[model samples]
Target chain A: MNWLGLVPFAIFSLLFLLLPTFNIVLGAFRTQQGAATLDNVMNLAQPRIAIAFWVSIKLSFASALIGCLLGFILATTVALGGLPRWLRQSTLTFSGVASNFAGVPLSFAFIATLGRVGILTIVIREVFGINLYGLGFNLLSFWGLVLVYLYFQIPLMILIITPALDGLRREWREAAEILGATGFQYWRRVALPILWPPTLGTMALLFANSFGAIATAVALTGSQLSIAPIVLFNQIRGDVLQDPQLGYAIAFGMIVITGITNLIYIVMRVRSERWLK
Target chain B: MKSARLWSYLIFLTGVMYFIIPLIGMFEFSLRKRRGEYSFDAYTSVLTDAQFQQTFLYSLLMALVAIVFGILLVVPTAYWVRLRLPKMRPVVEFVTLLPLVIPPVVIAFGYIRLFNTSSVLPFLGSQFGTDVLLSCGYVVLALPYMYRAVDTGLRAIDILTLTEAAQGLGANWPAIIFRVIFPNVLVAVLSGAFLTFAIVIGEYVISALLDRPAFGPYLVWIGSNKAYEPSALAVMTFAVTWGCMALIQVVTRFSKHTRTSI
Candidate 1:
């Protein structure tokens, strides 16, 4: 058999994933004239990089947490047959559409819907005499980006949470009821514990997902923000660093962060499988 | 108990509002006539706009290219890995998937530096070349979903035995992989293709980065000008995507029914 064809696939995967990273790591460790140096990485250890890194972590955590919880509530409501089948299906479909929706067009949709000159903002100001700008609803701020991310993030939560709810085992709920447990008691004593691990896992995936995403920040907030991938994108195109090497360095940093987050996700997923089994 | 049921009904109503209200707003904004009553003028104007029409075609063409290549490439990778490389499974698994956890913007940046002028590859020297390079990036971007579907489908079939049987008949690996093994994973490929189509058709990051005049950039154009046309475009985009989603559902149901009957 021609097992050698397999070699091409193996090599292609390795090279595609490796070479870009290689260019970056190599660039970051090189002199201005291309001699070996550690200055780039060392400079990254400076206070500015640290602050940006910490900020990204905190913001990603906040958005992912809120999104996961929102997703959980919505998913449980639907999965418990809180809605009829047709409605549930449509909502699920809409959730899929919204969750997949991101980038500039998504930002535009939100801006048109909620921006300063946006329809809702105009209507709210006209009908209720509520100044949204006074209320700080600008679509060009850190919080504004978070608000737009919520559009998709909540739907992602539903996608992950609905499956877990399906596996909730209705018999367990019935058994709890038979034992004279209240609904909250039944959920607390039985359901939440079973769902906790995957819920945690799903939330982590969402965190990593929104964290790595740069387009939302790009379209909504631009480089006035300090998000890592946004910074990296600017380094590449904006050339604020004024050197292609800086672009490689930023790409290298993004890869490392995404790699680490993905590792955590893999571990969590493994744990979830174990818990379920 | 009756009150709890009523509470559930209320929750359902809220859910409907949550999903439908945004769409309703998009529709009202799209259909309203500035000079008169409701009209189809905005949509007709959007469809007739040459750039919009071209971008729509360009996006459909990009999606079709990725969908075809994704099916051809991912199916074999998923199949060959399942049959021959069970020991190296997780590594192969993670390799195809590293794209997902890595943000698209990061990858888009990677493309710029990796493919920009004066890079190792001459292909990145121009915008057209960069656009195709962007397509390569799209293939990678869609890899996680496509690979996952194929991997799951491979697990559902006993491919090793089939490979052995084909080998015993003096069939070579390519013949077996292409003819016998490929047909078995059709459903997975179909589902993955639909997903790839949905993703690539509406893709904005790679297109925006590579500075291609695809549907996403066109949408941004319409958004800045004819407000109602942009809303109409959004509704159309939503319809197309939802249609693909419905295709996935139908394919899954058809596959499920087939498995049950067989």
Candidate 2:
């Protein structure tokens, strides 16, 4: 009787989440004629598809690594480094907004701030005589996308890791100090170990987050750039391959990568939670 | 401690600048419509445009539908799981998080394939049906935040005891849920609703693929085609997002105040 309450949610998830994903996975293993084959997966080995995957991996890796590092420093400053209390609250509140604030408006904001005739571009040129475009800084380039991705990625990391940092009790530090451990030694030996799981997990989460993002890249660079999600977007919109099964294969590949990364993140979160207990 | 505090101030200021500068630039650019001087011409132009009003209203209505459906679905399930099925938490959580991992384009693709004109359900059979599908997509996308907020709220209160007390008073399940459980978690539901509102308002991919006139795709349309108007739209979008976040803060603080006074 109690189990009946979950029926609606179960039906919703099965219809929307599980079945659609299963359809893609199943379609990836079939040809257009409905015959089972491995050609769809093999098509992923082509140079164009492989290069798309490579570019995506490089972007996700660079953004996640840099975002993790910078976010950790910022989170530490707010949660432990002892700024004003209101600063922490305001930062967190803003992080919540900035992290969710992606897609078209986000890209528009970046362009208004950094485009060739942008406000900052004009200011820097007039005041310091520095031409950002002359420095090869295109807002539509690969590195430019990373910079835009970081706008949200850093705050996401701060939001996720702040609580873990707060979990670092004062007693642990004092205990290590009493045991003749120096500050550096204490952090290296004690704090680092406890934080490893969450830090690594957050990086993995960020990797998956960036891997699946499409709108920001689309809005900023248009269809000219060849990121994984953009490739998938074009394929979905137009079936550019002329082979629907091949399109499913590309999406399946995306899911596989993000799924693995998310799995790692979940495992690490469980490990860290056990340590907390 | 003094040196550490100084370092904190330095790092915090740097982060604040990184976040604040783009917003300031967007606002300044939005005002630069009159050439060599700042004015509100861009804002006036955007606010006066008929398409802007149309798309903005469309997205606002869609956001409301998503919030209502999200609350109706999430609150009861969260309450029931807390009240009865503790073992189902992990399964429910994983399902909710699935939307985050799946890109919006992928989901929209799935919707196209799964509910096209020739499909069994045929959600895209007509414009109204397609709008329903778009709102459903928003609910799916916002599921993670909505479920987590409601679940966290449920956890804060004594669910089993409250339910039993309501039951002992001869109340039916619906009354117990609506009258008793709903009020207790109203704050959490409102937080989730505001977040959902923020997310659904500026969403582009799903609506664009579905060929809906959402504010998100309209923003993109202007962004590629217009000059200063895109900056004006950016400022407007940022203001809407900021307003939602402020409302969340106000709701949370109000809840705390009421809880303490009681």
Candidate 3:
């Protein structure tokens, strides 16, 4: 009788979420006539598809690494760096907002700030007499997207890692001090050991977060960049490659990558929670 | 300690600058619609645009539908899982978190492939059907946050006790869920709803692929077509997101205050 309560929810999930995903995963392996084959999956080795996957991975890695470093620094400064209470409070509130402020508007904001004829670009050219374009900085390039991604990625990192930082326990630091440990020695021996798990976990989450991003990339770079999401977007819109199964393969590959990263994140989070507890 | 504090402040200032410069630049750029003078021309244009109005309203309606449907689906399930199916907690959690692992583009692709006009369930056969599919996609995208919020709220209140008391009073399941459990977790539900609104309003991949007139696709369309107006729209979008987060804070604080007063 009680099991009947989950019926509607179960039906909704099965229909909308599970079945669609299962269809995609199933399509990735099947041929046009529905015969199971490895041809589509093997087609992922083509230069176009492979390059898209590689670029996507590199972008995700760069943004996640940089976001983690910067976010950890900012979070540490606020949580343990003797900042005023109000600053910390406001920083957190701002982070909660900024982390969710991704997709198209974020790309728009970045373009207005860094695009050609953008205010900062004009300012730099007028004041410093140096053209950012001449300096080989294009907002549509790889590094440009990383910079834009960092806007939200860093805030997300700060939000996720703050509690773990708070769990660093003042007693442990004081105890290390009383044991004649230097600051560097304390961090190396005590703090870093404890913090590394959550930091790395957050990096994994950040990687997956940016890995799956499409709107910001599409809005900012158009179809100029061959990142996996954009490629998939184009494929879905018009079948640019004229092969729907290869598109499924690409989407399958994305699911696999993000799935692995998120799995790592969950594992690392569990390990860190044990220690934090 | 002195040097450490100074270093912290330096890093903090740098972070602040990195975050603030784009916003300042955007605002400044948005005012550049008129040569040699700052004006709100760009904002006015964006605000008055017909496509913007239509797409914004369409996304807003979709967001509302997603929130209501999400609450209906999630609240009862979360309540029941807590009260009756505690052993299935991990499975429920993993299923909820699947959206985070699977990208929105992939999910949207799956929907296209599975529910196209030729498929058994032709959700994309019409605009209304596609809108339903898009709303369900938003709910899936937001499942992680919504489920976590409701679950955290359930943990705060004693569901077992509430359910037992409601049962002793001869109330049915729907009444207990709606009357007893729902009120207790209203704050959590509202927080989740605001987050959902934030996500659905600016969503791009699902709605874009589905060919829906959503604000996200509209933003992207304008971004490519217009110059300064994109910045003004960006500012507006940022405010909407900020408003959502702010409301979540306000409600959570309000809930705490009422609890303390009680």
**Compared with the true structure, what per-residue lDDT tens digits does model 3 show for residues B1-262?**
8999999999999999989989888888889899889999998988888999999999999999999999999999999998889888898899999999999999999999999899899989998999999999999989999999999989888889999999999999889999999998999999999999999999999998999989998888888899889999999999999999999998988989435111
- Fnat of all models, as shown: 0.28, 0.68, 0.86
What docking class should model 1 receive? acceptable
Top-DockQ candidate index? 3
Error of 2 at B247 (Å): 1.4
- Worst-scoring 10-residue span by lDDT in model 1 chain A: A12-21
lDDT of 2 by residue, B1-262 (tens): 7887888889888988888888888888889889889899999999999999999999999999999988988999999888889899888998999997787777887888888899898999999999988998999989999999888888788888999999999999999999999999998899899999999998988998899999988887888888889889888888888899899888888888445111
In model 2, which regions exceed 4 Å deviation? B257-262
Candidates in order: C-alpha RMSD to true structure? 3.1, 1.9, 1.6
lDDT of 2 by residue, A226-253 (tens): 8888888788777466667778888889
Model 1 agreement with the true structure over B1-262: per-residue lDDT tens digits? 7776677777767756655555666666677646668788888988889998899899888888877777777777778767766666787777788777667776666566566688667556886786667677777878888888888878777888988999999998689978987787777778888888877876766687778888876665556566677667777777777787788777777888435111
Candidate 2 residue B30 C-alpha distance from true site, Å: 0.8
In terms of TM-score, the best-performing candidate is 3
Model 3 lDDT per residue over A1-277, tens place: 8788778878888888898888889999999899999999999999988999999999999999999999999999999999899999899999999999999999888888889987788989999999999999999999999999999999999998988989988899999999999999999999999999999999999999999998999899876789998899899887586889888888999999999999999999998998898
TM-score of each: 0.89, 0.97, 0.98
